[model samples]
Target: MSDFASAAMLRVLVQGMRELGLDPGDAPPGDGEARVQLGLKQGLVQRAVLQGGLACLPLLGRGLRRLAHEPTHQALVAAHSASDLLARWQRLERYVHSRHRCVVEHCDDTQACVRHVTVTGQGAPTAAEDFVVAGVLAALLESIGLRRVSLSFGEQGLFPASDPQGLAQAAAAGASALWQFHWQGRPARGSAPVPGPAAWAQGADPAWAEPVRRAYLHLAADLARPWGLPVLAGAMGLSTRSLQRQLAAQGLSYSRLLAEARCRVAAWRLLYTGDPVAEVGFLSGFSDQPHFTRELQKRVGMPPAAYRQAFAARPVPGR
Candidate 1:
């Protein structure tokens, strides 16, 4: 992904974290700024937040970079915790919106800028969250004084029944991009689409910062793989062993990431599709149905069949 796309992804991520109700702020020791600077220098930001949404920080950082110009990219990895990134995103979103008048202009068809996110992951299926996030971002753009916006998502994103209008409204207002879980080549959860620069860049946020955005795109595209540690490591230009060490510094591992991705994807699939329990398991990286059932129960508090029965019966937004 280009730096521009990375920055946009970051913006959406930070904005989403704020909506999740976490404290995303700078620390008193000037350490917060230092961390960000360091992350820039290192060209990466790696963190694992227990309950604070650190996973979304890189995206936030990418967004913030567009507003400022700095050279520290490699040294910046593993800087802020997820909480810090969220706080920064909230700050930036407010900063941008306060200065501009945002608008939403839907394209009769998807535009090139909008295609960046979708093209990053090979064979990845687009999700409703992409549309949800885009709408939320449009609202934010309008709030910031941008005059026009044009974006679109796949058919899955269009159905009123699948993506809720209320959630879309909240996301557009710089709130969390309400998400829904689903799978493509592998199990994945779709996040709200990041706002485009044309929509968010109103001369309020600084420019000239390129590295942060680069890192953001790297991270976002990196994470989309399904249990391919070697592949992800290669994409980031790190050796598998080195990658493990870096992730260790931030309290994460390939296995854990794989598990998290699988669980979220499985949860979404269970709730969204009519796929059989065994198929959901297989698609989610579970080799056996029993293991899939056990894991589903652990994460969702119900067996796959039961979870589907319950979710299928419930009313969904934009359904």
Candidate 2:
């Protein structure tokens, strides 16, 4: 089975697009079309699907309505690649910019809001220490200068966490947009977009791990905190070193998992909350502010204060 955690991020985007005024007519070419259009480079379309998924969340489908196009009635062989998805998003961003009027303004400190965007492309197989898909999406939004965004593992509405075929088929058929407008243009500010805070997967599943699919479900609300393997191992009745061996057998490591968790937590805290820089660090389990600053800058392309300043300065939409 694939990463269900990652799959849900796309649901957030589909939801976000509808919130932005997207209609069925504005839907872009599917993943298959995107790949064939790009000649199957690598992960482009997949990354774009993931990135657009998140960037479109806060706006709901309104952004999608803005992007809708006449369905390509011509059928072409379907191919899947993450890079092709990213290219499709690049096309979408260009379309959004060209057709819409967007401005970046400042907001009052207390009223400011941080939003995390999550998106995933189609897949049924898991990859190695690569569950940090949300981070990749956040980076995509930042590239377009929407630098004030956070990320979360979305609820894909699929069942049987191990291998939810229903959700996967829905995602493929574009039924993933069911919850796009559920947020109703309401502002969450520092609160998480997901009803309960959700934690993202650090990496791939271990070879010998139990069949439980919702391993990261409890972490949904705790996105602000780093859920380290040591803690998880403690919960799973294994020593940290032993856990390391288990993940190692699957071609992963505790450090890799920790890094993914840390990166995602830092991204959410930095983007969605006005929490003080030091507190953001502490909340994300970074004992040192300097370390947090360095890593956040590396991940977000700027210092926390500057990032917050840029976003907080922007007036809340319609304020």
Candidate 3:
């Protein structure tokens, strides 16, 4: 069918499943000119922790990260400008020969939004599939060296990406999924450098953590304390200004790190521990129960209880 995904793309999902400690129960689709059906893709994603929650972004991002080495992504990375990148993307859609693909609704110097619909002007029936699409596009953007990039997915006034309260409301949207992409222009260098890996995906408990990650650990150690930049900077053996510059370079701030740490810790506890959701949120740097539910809901794409149940349904690894 025209609504099919590339085998290379599906393989990335397989890797994400493996990493999440989920069993690769069935053989994922394989690469070939013969198109693999979208049903295969839908079946694969249905097995994930949740359909569309905050966790979906990074999980899909993690899977699509493999695309950095694929041809479509490589071509996108090779694009010289933001508009140029869109042009190349249009060309890639043609090359795929899929009726269901992303089409640019508008473009400009600052921000642009792409609508993921079919030639019939319909969005993917599956929410998770659309998410996979957004993740790939986001990866391509990051490869272009736009360090501070975030995306809003919904129709106008449904939800702005910045409004924490409305994420899930927009997420529950039906067909006709839209993606509004925001990014900073490339650095003031000689020319647009070749697209490499998206720096944002360089997270998780890597062998060597980023400076911001070290800062995350420090802040995570005590989420209740109202620590400032100076104290954290000193703890990291960096001057206040130096720490600010470093965090800015990585598209991070101390508060952002603290929030992220809480999210990470909360997710971990929900999945592997029997702690009550309220208690888990409290220990993860959240002092207010309602605030904890809201933030984690924004991040993980659901309430704490729901998130725990989603992943908890998965077949644990090594069992």
* Top-lDDT candidate index: 3
Predicted candidate 1 versus true structure: per-residue lDDT over 82-200, tens digit per residue = 22222222332222221111122221221222221322334221222344334443333222222333223332232112234543454345333222212112101222221121121
Note the Cα lDDT for every prediction shown: 0.36, 0.35, 0.59
lDDT of 3 by residue, 1-319 (tens): 3575555556667766666566546855454231356667667777663533434433554554554544333445655456656765554454344566777888776777888777755544455566666666665667677666667665422211233235345556563267777878772332333221122233344642377667776665444334579978987899999888877877777677767777876676567655445445544556445777899889878998788888863532320
TM-score, cand. 2: 0.29
**Candidate 3 lDDT (Cα, whole model)?**
0.59
Question: Which of the two candidates, 1 or 2, achieves a greater TM-score against the reference?
Answer: 2
Best by TM-score: 3
lDDT of 1: 0.36
Least accurate 10 contiguous residues by lDDT in model 3: 191-200
Question: Which residue segments of model 2 deviate by more than 4 Å?
Answer: 1-230, 238-242, 309-319
Identify the superior model by lDDT, candidate 2 or candidate 3: 3
Native-to-model Cα distance after best TM-score fit, residue 145 in candidate 2, in Å: 45
Give the residue spans of candidate 3 off by over 4 A: 19-24, 27-29, 49-54, 57-59, 120-123, 154-168, 187-319
Give the range of the ten consecutive residues with the poorest summed lDDT in model 1.
70-79
lDDT of 2 by residue, 201-270 (tens): 4332444354122233323233333356666676566687776776676555656545555566556545
